[model samples]
Target: MTEAEMLMEEKLRKKKEEEEEMWAEYLEQRKKQRAKEEEELRKLKERQAKRKLQRAEQESKMNEYKRKQEEQRIREMEEKKSREAEAKRKRLEEAEKKRQAMQAAKEKREQEPVKPNFVISKREGDEMGSALGSSGLDKFANIMYARGEMGKTKEQMEEDKKAILSFRVKPLEIEGLTVEQLRDMAKKLWEKVVALESDKYDLEERQKRQDYDLKELAERQRQINRSRALKKGLDPEALQGKHPPKIQVSSKYERRLDRRSFEDKRELYDGGLEAMTDAEMEKMWEDKMNSFKEQSRGQLPKWDPENPKNKQVSHIRRLEEEDDDEELVPVFEPPKPEPPKPAAPPPKPAQQQEEEEEEEEEEEEEEEEEEEEEEEEEEEEEEEEEEEEEEEE
Candidate 1:
């Protein structure tokens, strides 16, 4: 080998060696970069998986919340339906109870025995007459008199008149009273008139007897005066006084003898039945009945005692029962008389009578003493009993 050729070959070997080192460094760098890129890709894939799991968990929570809400809504609907059903059941039960009670009452009413009704019909002759006029004002006046509320004062009369005019319509006027009330009033008036007439007749008969006695006495006095005049040998006619006393009774004496009372004349018109004959009474009764029927127009319904709606039984019977209860006085029997003692023998003389009386008085005194002793003994016995009771207590 020549020296020049050895130098060129050494230079080429050195260049080749340098090029191989650079290539090896470049490959190492490429390997490191690939590994770093792979690590980055692995980290990114893990983060993506975590996020997907969290999203799935959130979706599950949302679905659970929606399911709970649906269940709650269903439960509330069921509760509301139960409350309405309970209310409806209560209402139905109340209605059924009321219906059953009403049915029971009806059955009881039907099963009870019905009592026969007795109606006391007013007699045609017992009806009120035309004592009052045939006008509305007169009818009200009749009611006032019948009810015993006839006012004495003008103001009171006017007020009562107004009240009667304004009275509400009912089955019958005058506080819904029946026609029998007026009949009863007429009957009372008739009785009062009869009593007053009887008293007057008695007084008149007494006056007639007194007048007869007075005339007999006057005749006896005249006969005695004539006898005295004849014995004196004077004319009986000439013996009279210049002014002979008139045969008249004093007015004060007549008034004192009269027995009629003030109450007898009150409300008495034509003296009622006292002046009427039997035929006249019958005729008047018939007329009065006809008049009452005409006036009333036959609107009064017959009263039944057994009917619950009848006012006569309600008010009149209850009032009578109350009066009876109030006046239930106890009757006490009189004490029985003691048996008579044996009679003593009559005294033969006045001295014997006086001696017997003295003996009787002495015996009475001894009896009184004995009675006093007995009373004292009884009082002591009572006191001893009281003391014994106190000691026992």
Candidate 2:
């Protein structure tokens, strides 16, 4: 071979060997990079799987929360519905109970017995006939019906009449009541009638007095006005005393007899006294008078039972006495008489009699001696005790 051919071959061999080494190194590097990339991808896939698992768990928890909330809402709704139903039931029950109570009351009223009218002889036969034309008979009938002595309908009247007739009538007997009781009742009735008459008279007198006072006041006012005009240099003949007649209006005047505090009086006054009726005014006056009397009674001095005037009074006399402390004499009580003893039995036989006589004599002697000594000793002890008490005092 030529030297150039040998050198060319050697150079080609060296280039080939270098190319093989480089290819081997590139393959090893490519293998190492592929293993690193596969490892990173695996780690990323594991992270993504973990994230998906977490998201799934979160979604499950959210679903559970929503479900629990829905259940709670449903329970609340049920409870509210139940409460409303219970309230409605209670209201219905209450209404039913009230309705039943009213029905029972109505039934009781319907079943109640009514009084019967006992017809008496008329004062005048034609009195009702005269009243009929004036509508007074109808009013009286209505009053009778209201008193249950009459009925509105014919059927009701018949029923009432039948029911009243069924009861056995007995004669009213006046008994048991004492003469004193009757007299007291009569006296009370008489006093009531007299009081009513007196009250009526007092009212009339008060009205007349008020009218006279008002007239006098008006006259005085006119005179005052006339004097004022004269003083002002107006002609006496031309200037009339009367300007205009004053309109009289009913008014109430309160006199505080108890002297209540200013605040209390103001409170009472502020409540408005303009609308009080005559009766109301009278009642207020009575109440005030009673309060005054009560206060006066409380302030009154206490009575001394040790006083001579009260000495004869009984233990309970203080309770019965009036607030004025008047002297009250007690009623005297007579002493009760002792009952008489029965007569003695007949004397016994001689031996028993002898023994009895001996016993009697002995008892008589002991009694006689006992009486003298007891009397003397009692008197001495009494005197000594009195002296000792006085000395101690």
Candidate 3:
């Protein structure tokens, strides 16, 4: 081989080796870059997973907190409702207890018996006993026995004895009572008696007033019946059949009358017949009237000017004064009614357009019918004339 050729070959070989080395280095660099990219991707995924987990935990905690808050609110509301219900129940119980207590007190007061200042004793055992002498002691014992037999309990007897002992006799003085105190006591007692008498008088007056009102009501009913008969064009005498009989009541011997059975008596009273004499009824009526008058006087206004109906009462008084000698004055009549207003005038022609149009149409139709009839008559006449002329020819 030529020396030049061999040198050329060796140089070519060295150049080829250098090219291969450069290729290997480039491949190694590419592999390292790919591995680095994969590691970076793994790190990013881990960080993202951690953030997601943290967000999920936060949401769960918030939900749990909300649930606890809701539970707490519900519990508070339940507690408040229970408290209110308990309070209401207690209030109702208290009210019921008060009512029961009041009823019991009223019943007790009603059941309590009225006691008098003095009592007499009766018994056979004390007949021979001491100081009063045998007959007087026997009489006292008999009285005590009689009292015991007359439905008086032992406690009631003792109370009566105590009251008798405590009572002050005439021309007697109490240790603590001065003249002024005695006078005051007497005045109070007098006033109480006066009040009782006044009450009795008022009751009588009230009864009388009620009787008057009842009579007035009966008269009014009669008048109303008569008026109704007149309106129906029936005979007024027919009202006599409808009239109720007069009722009579007793005033004296009131013990026979049981006020507790007043409702039962009302039915009998409505039958309109006297169960008592006229004198008794009159006495009762007087008592009731006096009682009512007294009550009315007591209830009168302190000052007449303060009354709402004062003006009306004053007007009544003025009317009474105008007729000084008049007794049993009649109640004032209502004012007369005002005259009725005249009816309105008829509507003008402009408002009657529809009616006018109908009338015109009817008239036109009638005229047309008449003209048609006349034409028919004329035709008939012509025909007759033609017939006659033909005959003559």
Candidate 4:
């Protein structure tokens, strides 16, 4: 072996060992840097987690505060509603009380009687008592008893006995009153009650009397209706209407003519007269006569206005009437009828005269014919008889 080859191999081996040792040292430094990076990452993660937990706690506190505020608002609203309800109830109760009070006052006023302004003096009361008869005095005593100024009646005593028997405690022993005092108090109460009963009885009797009077009045009215129906020529038994027969008074009482115009007034004398009953027309005529008498008191003068001698006086009176604003009515006379025309002679009984004349003519003709026939018959008989005689000779 050459000595240079051995030496170069040894140097190569030494260089390889140095390279391995440097590589191992660099690996150890890398491991240490990785461990430090892991530690810093863990610390940063812990800081982020702590910040998130703090934010969650703050949000929960805000939610809790809002919930409490809402609950308090709801409580205040409920209290306000209750206060309003209580105020309304009180107002309604007060209104009802006022209404009841007014009703009670009205009832009290109606139950009480009217009082006179002046009071009776003691002397006047004594005089009135002295003037009363026995019956009037008894009535006066009843009034006094009702006013609590008199004694008890028999019915009142009976009522007092009943009241005493119904009591739980004896009135004589109550309130440390004596037996005589209790009796007196009971008598006074009984007298008041009896007076009230007497007043009720009087009212009942008065009502019965009023009903009887009403019945009598109704019967009298019925009788009057029957009499009126008879006078009016109407049948009372056949009447079906509630009202009485119509009995119209004359127009004189009604004064219907006072409402008539002059043209309408003329209808009374014309066709309107036919519509009036005989009694009404007669009454109207009587009224007219009375009105005429009243109106003609100083209407006409003694002298006629148409006379020649009274012309000057009439003219002066007319001037005065004109000055007095009065209208003068002119008088009219009825016209005389024309003389009657000469009448023609009355016609004779022509048919009867003609029959009489015809009978006389027939009698004359029969007499003439009888005379001629007899002459003829006599001539013929003589001629025959003469012939026979001749024959016999």
lDDT of each: 0.72, 0.72, 0.74, 0.73
Q: What is the per-residue lDDT of model 3 for residues 94-170, given as tens digits with 9 covering 90 to 100?
A: 65566569657866977999778376566666654543444765677768866765887888667555543343223
Report the Cα RMSD per candidate. Answer: 55.3, 47.6, 41.5, 53.5
- Clash total of candidate 3: 30
Using TM-score as the measure, the top candidate is 2
lDDT by residue for model 2 (1-393), tens: 999999999999999999999999999999999999999999999999999999999999999999999999999999998898577556446655665696578669779897665755455666656633435776776577468643357876675455343432334344898889888877977986796698699989999999999999988876877787688655453345345433222222435344555566556645445545766989999999999999889555456554333553754575566533544655577988988988998968899989998999999999999989977876786677557756766
Worst ten-residue run, lDDT, model 3? 163-172
lDDT of 4 by residue, 1-393 (tens): 799999999999999999888888888888898899999989988988998899899999999999999999999999997887577456445645665686578769879998884764444445444544335667776577557523777875675455434442344445878889989988987986796698799989999999999999988887887777677667774343665545423244464447656666665567554556776989999999999999998655344444443665788888998966744555576989998999987866989889999999999999999989977876786677557756766
**lDDT of the structure predicted as candidate 2:** 0.72
Report model 2's TM-score to 2 decimal places: 0.28
Give per-model TM-scores.
0.24, 0.28, 0.23, 0.23
What's the TM for model 1? Answer: 0.24
Preferred candidate (TM-score higher): 1 or 4:
1
In angstroms, how far off is 26's CA in candidate 1? Answer: 4.0
Predicted model with the maximum lDDT: 3
lDDT tens digits, residue span 1-393, model 1: 999999999999999999998889999998999999999999999999999999999999999999999999999999998898577556446655665686578779879999775754555644353333245666776587657544357875675455443432123344655789978866877986796698699989999999999999988988887888788655675446666434322243354563544455343444556656876878999999999989888555445454433554688889999989877976687998998987997748988889999999999999999989977876786677557756766
